[model samples]
Target: MMCNSASGSAAGFLLFTDVDGCLVNKNDYGFAPAVPVLRRLRTEGIPVVLASSKTGCELQHLAEQFELEPAPLICENGGEILWRESDGGNTRTVAGAERSKILRALNGLKPTFQFRSFADLELHGVMAATNLSEAEAIRALDRHSTEPLIWDDAPDRIPVFAEYLQEFGLTLTRGGRFWHVAGNASKGSAMDIVIQHYRSRLTTPVTTIAVGDSPIDQDMLDRADIPIAIPDPEGRFHVQVSSNGHRAGEAGSLGWAETMTRILDDVTGCD
Candidate 1:
């Protein structure tokens, strides 16, 4: 793990965090803990970017709630990278022929899988799965031997659901419970793009800290100088956090906040 020393006054540390599993609980509560922590980071002039499987619309709402200046938002499990308003209102989408090709191939394999584009689903709500329970959906996908993106209401089921999809050459990701099934695009890959963008604009080496909890968060966790998991007891992915707490049930967002504060203190030599 890379720790930023307080002895040197560098530009600032870049804090990359996931939304659903790391900062917000499955029920989307425990947002209070994150608000103050983020406020402190901003007061200290650190950059905190939200990188998640969330769509641009979802991320936009989160950014506003977090009081972020639209730091680079990574959406669709790294399939798209959008520079929030601060980075210029430029939104870079990674979906192109490759994504289209994958969709086409999947469609051919399972016609009843209800293939729909993100835009299409958002605008028309056509082909959306409105009747499937999380477990039922996964079972249905398994029976078909097809990996269809599922939109489950439960947040905790995402990791297991994603793992189950791997057998069918597909994976499940969430941008706030609207399950997204796509190719290998991941949050880590999108974070890489965000890091490179910042690196290009910097003269000094900047430290990157990625924090999340879930299988989808692994990519970003592995890419960070410091990876912090939010202490999910039900999580199948391995993560190392400084501490664990019980404020947010099994969701663990408050635990993540506590871990972040501890890690920052250690890095700053305040401990």
Candidate 2:
């Protein structure tokens, strides 16, 4: 987390948020309850960026439908970034073996580990695993960088699977409810890029507020100027987070809205 200009304290803020369990209902993925706060942010000229383990395609669709279009998006757990502006958009993908190469490496495990990657799953399987609609599952299949795997939690042989993947420069991490495999990319890196973009564009330095609900968002949350941690549906946080930041009483979208409203009151300085 690079230090900003001295005047950053009085400057307005930019937001980098996670979608699944942070901005939306973890169980249903609906974000309607956060609408008023989202609209207020727009009115106050605060940029709301979506950073998530979901693919670029998923975030792109949400950016449009949720009225966050033209906003920068951190996708595939920061495996890729979509920076959109009024003129056009640009993408920066991290250096790593694409999922195809990683998949081949995993396939070398042969009959040892049954590969249950998102690529191999049928619509029903995707729906059952993610609780996403058919259309949403199709959007999820548009992944280009990381492979989201539904591992069966094999202990003894899991080390071997990880070792083989390391040979290909692939790293795996636990995400929402699945295992995400990718190269050396993270949400923090994407946040850095977005923060730099904001610094370059705005005359007044921008403060960043990051909100997340899970361990997957730790990198972004830790790096943000302000970090808000929303609890799980069971009203528990996945990791220790935001001791100084506000906590939402409820979970999911309501929690998201609850926290966002606080931010609006505390930061925006708008009536």
Candidate 3:
């Protein structure tokens, strides 16, 4: 059910977002430009759910900074969740694979493969790779289930890794800068679960809006009632069949706010 937002309209929207390259720049990772839209969303009581390859520590910190607490945030590209203010006590929303299992599978990979997961990257290495401060990188190192990997010079080796992961009932997904390894967890799958949860609580029909920049987000885009594809730093929109939904006016922070602001306006128009 869709409850009225602060606009008093009988419509509620659930926006699931990708944090990197979608909400913030992949290089610098600043979201100042999107602050206004974020504020408006909060004011309207619209739930802004983060679906990212980041860990719960990072997501929780970001959510707290945005005052978006009590909203479950999807992490590790949907392999795990940090449920907030929910009935059930932070259970893994599917993707129940253990961290040890994922690491063990990674160890089984051929030495020729240059794929390095977060588990391999020590704290200092994580800081260097992500450009996050020491504490921030430490938070990022905290993973529950899925493993984010950085594939080096061997692009051809990717398929082989995928094959091995499949044998172990795992899969690989390419995000903006890294690949995510998980079992039966995706942005789309997690969003579906969260959207259904929201619908169960609200009083009106729920409208889901999903936004992202990389191909990693294709499933989420397809699942959204309104899919918005933001351009990359090169200013190219890559989401397949994007014309069927919408492309943002710009890339990164500006595009995120632009598309979100427009959607918020349209929702308010329904009032």
TM-score for each prediction? 0.67, 0.88, 0.91
lDDT comparing candidate 2 with the true structure = 0.78
lDDT over C-alpha atoms for residue 237 of model 1: 39
In model 2, how large is the Cα lDDT of residue 199?
88
Per-residue lDDT tens digits for candidate 3, residues 1-271, read 2334575752577888899888887888888888888887878877889989888889888887766636878888878877776453454554547777888888988465777788888898888888999999989888878888888856887898799899998888888888888877787888878888888898888988889888778999999888999898888877863555788888898889888877777677633
Q: What is the lDDT of residue 74 in candidate 1?
A: 74
Off-target runs (Cα >4 Å) in candidate 1 are: 1-10, 95-103, 111-148, 151-179, 233-250
User: For model 1, how does the per-residue alpha-carbon lDDT over 66-91 read when each residue is reduced to its tens digit?
Assistant: 88765777765666676766645665
Candidate 1 vs candidate 2, TM-score winner:
2
- Candidate 3: clashing residue pairs, number: 3
Write one digit per residue (lDDT tens) for candidate 2, span 1-271. 2332323343558889989888878777788898877876676667889988887888888887788647888889888887777776665655445778877876776577865888678677888889888999988887777888888756566677777778888887777788888888888887888788788878886788888877778888888778888888778887556576666788888888988876666554434
The residue ranges of model 3 lying beyond 4 angstroms of the native Cα positions read 1-5, 86-94, 241-244
Between prediction 1 and prediction 3, the one with superior TM-score is: 3
**Candidate with maximal TM-score:** 3
lDDT (C-alpha, whole model) for all candidates: 0.60, 0.78, 0.81
State the lDDT at 80 in candidate 1. Answer: 65
